[model samples]
Target chain A: MTSLYWAVADGWTITRRDLTHWVRQPTPIILGLLFPIMLVLMFGFLFGGAIAVPGGGDYREFLLPGMFVMTVAFGVEGTMIAVTTDAARGVTDRFRSMPMAQSAVVVGRNGADMLDSVLVLAAMIGCGLAVGWRWHGGPGATLAAVGLLLLLRFALLWVGIYLGLVVGGPETVAAVQILVWPIGFLSNVFVAPETMPAWLGTVAAWNPLSATVSATRELFGNPGWGGQSWIAQHATVMAVLWPLAIIAVFFPLSVRAFRRMSR
Target chain B: MSVVAEGLHKCYRDKSALDGFDLTVAEGRVCGLLGPNGAGKTTAVRILATLLRPDGGRAEVAGFDVTRHPAEVRRRIGLVGQHAAVDEVLSGRQNLVMFGRLYHLSSARARARADELLTQFGLADTGDKAVKQYSGGMRRRLDLAASMILAPKVLFLDEPTTGLDPRARNEVWAATRALVADGTTVLLTTQYLDEADQLADDISVIDNGQVVGNGTPDQLKTKIGGDRIDLVLHDADDLAAAAATVSRVTGADTDIDRDDRRLSAPVRNRVAALVEASRALDDAGIAVEDIVLRRPTLDEVFLTLTSAGTGHGPRETGRE
Candidate 1:
């Protein structure tokens, strides 16, 4: 009820409004959860026979971690579009004039999107387990991997908020989504970077999303590079470092752009 | 409480938005800024609101310098910008509560204020509806309510009544009257001369990035003097003779302008001049097309000062 309490409630109230908007449709979020499920069905049944898990386990096991990271990448686009819509509709301008802490608006909305991301992650993982995927590692390590994916999602949402703020004009934002899909697929989410060409392997390894996926694969005890490179041995390090680095770089940038928006 | 600015200068490349603009408003009073679009009225309001920093000069609101102590100034002032400032995705009641919460009010207090504002604006029935569903006037009223939640000592309303129907404008005017009655100092910029005339106790007329005039409505009206007479004649040749007759008899400057119209300079006696002018025009066989006598409106005063037609000196210099 105090001022700080208001600050907390302010963020969630804004977030809840978006939740209500999504609840009205329930299609996009449902589809995001379903698209990866469809991928799991096609790859597990159709292509599982030829795929190799490198003497680790079933193809579904390897694919689950990849799909989780892919969902994070795909979900960033939704956040980007939402931010763009808010900007285009003059909702962002309306927020600027109020006495509200400017950063809380974007932060609160992203926090709301994170709720959707968590639900989608849980449902996708549920469908994966319903098939033949197994987590050899203990539940503790499994929880840690889930932690990494959420951090990655949170980090990427801020980046999307910044991108949305940068491209203030909305018409071109959707066109820019085409560029995002390629970047999401090019990372080590679906295939090991070693299988890619040498130049692409380098790019795949350095991708921030790759850090989380590579880290998740190890934590799940499924399949990874297995200490062939520094990232394989230090996946946990990269998992934490990448999201922190993104937050460090993008958080203030978003807030500064927001403050200067009204100025 | 008071907003005082001196030597304020702001510019946009190749165009000056504010040219050494100066404004002074004492505490607990409603000050209206009347000007056409692009007159730098909004620019001055933004500077006072701390939403903008002047390229030069200084401004203070409630004893805090706008540029140096912008946060302090912001805490003391509220701004309802030209564009409505409510989140359209949120309901009208939610919008007010959100702003109230932003001002650090408790949830119960915020909700109370939201309900109060909704009822005050006649929006209680539609309080649960999203702002996008509300008419332009309703959204505008909500925008006003958002700025007023803090009961700020200084409120900046930038073009508050623009694009509203007459009834909606009256609603906003009523709100303004109520706010001023409650001892909230207001500084509003408007292109609607009538709104300013009705709501503002003190009027400041800005033109081309400068203050052309400032006063109470009655003072400004008196400064412009009595009603004017303009006539249209049937033909140019006949109009010129009519112009000669009227000018000689009334000793008023008369000219046969375009469209065979004659403009007779100020006449204190409208009835006497209308009868004499009509009689002379009739004798000259110049049929009178139309005749009208009316007080000089704010529009005319604005046109005169800003359009370079009057050739009068600085509007405030000789008057004060």
Candidate 2:
């Protein structure tokens, strides 16, 4: 029981250390929050006119849920950069040398990053409202949509941490940032999958991001591609299952990767 | 003994970092590991710190086997690596407190310990500044302060003052001396022979992944030779006469440099050799520019031992 308590305490201290960074250097956090706002305006107004939703509704409304998923997905790179920087700077080694719980660093990193995702999600949601995006569903369904988005963020957090440990240092971190884009655009975020070629459309529809976006769009009562595919019909199940599956695989993988660093 | 290692070996791909390395550090004394680059000093440290496992052999630190009881060894040791392992974004006090908390100190105790360390390491004035704004010396001092938080039985410092200015190096030296006074056994690896001379009670000269020589600083210095009388002649023509006079007086092999007009010869007794050489030069009418009796430095000892194969030659005066 005391060991469990100490883990939580150590994890909270690490989380607080990251929180101090947010307070001391607000520029990066502010810039990170503002980048998505810029994207919302660009895609909602500049490019929204050219793009069409399959089932006619406001383009901003259709784009908002997709952007929400994109904003969370984008967090993967930021988390990876932070982890790799710590590893390169020897902070990871310092923590490893100490008598603290081995899992505290990852737990703390995930905890602080989850908090960051919440703040980013809230800001993107505000940006969505300003651009005339709305959800016709009741409070419970709306809350469920937000929960699904965070779940996806939590799952991707492990992936980011794992990759950060595998590809150490800043240069390799910049290289891994390139992967986030394909994972982002190759989903249902920017365009309806049905708009692409049949094979490409299937790939997009099956993306994990697509599951969260499609599920949230359904809950928000917003217009989406009314595909007759079974995956589209069961978006909510896939939404929960996909993240759980990712967590199951990547969580252990990330912890093992972290342990392997000492070797 | 606080640390013990025997026949330790480690290999990296096609390179051998440690080949039959051995070390033993007694309680409450500093054991310096002197070596050039790629000499396996760091590999030995990493193994003892429980950060890496050796491919072969056995080691114990603080009464626990490093491989079988890493957690126990970790609990009793502190390691300060080459680079400062500190958060640049956090203040010195915050960094120290965070480390204290991670060591399981209570909030109140952690804060108190941070303040104490800040004052002890002369960081009290700038404890609130972000570490990014700190000078390199201050950052290193803070790094040292961080490692001392737990007051472990043993501490490992890898090149603690490798890049510091002389004054900052003295500051770290003083801090290390203070730690020794408090009874912490330190194992320091350094490339600076003078650093080992100043701080170490005993030094193990490592080269090519093995201990080529080990002894007290004075013993290592005496390995190359004893005190020597150096004479610089005022005139180039006086070189041979000065060398002949010093050889006749000390009855030792004299090394003469023609261009510099300098003659040096090994001496058994420093003051007697100096007096006798002065009288001999006066009798020969050799105009002496300067003459002094000097001892061999650790630099010469290191060069002789490392360059001399097997380090078991007749010139290798000290062993064990």
Indicate which candidate wins on DockQ.
2
| Error in Å for residue B151 of model 1 | 2.5
Note the residue pairs that clash in candidate 1: B1-B62
DockQ of each: 0.34, 0.68
User: lDDT per residue, candidate 1, A1-263, as tens digits?
Assistant: 45566467668767876786675457777777788889888878888778666555667777788888888877777877788777665456556545565556875877788998988898988887899777778999999999999999999888888888877565656666677667766777666777778888778778888888878888888776543667656778998999999999998988887766544
lDDT of 2 by residue, B1-320 (tens): 99999999999887999999989999988999999899999999989988888999999999999999987888888888888889999999999999999988889999999999999999999999999999878988899899889899999999999889998899889888988899999999999999999999999999988999888999887776777777889999888778788888888767777777878777887888889899889988989999988887787678777753332222333332
Please identify model 1 stretches exceeding 4 Å from their true place. Answer: A1-59, A78-103, A106-110, A194-196, A224-235, B11-16, B68-72, B165-167, B221-226, B234-265, B268-272, B307-320
Report the C-alpha lDDT of model 2 over A87-146, residue by residue, as the tens digit.
Answer: 887788788878888789998998899999999999998888887999889999999999
For all candidates in order, state the fraction of native interface contacts they contain: 0.29, 0.75
Chain B TM-score for candidate 1:
0.86
Scored by lDDT, model 1 comes in at: 0.77
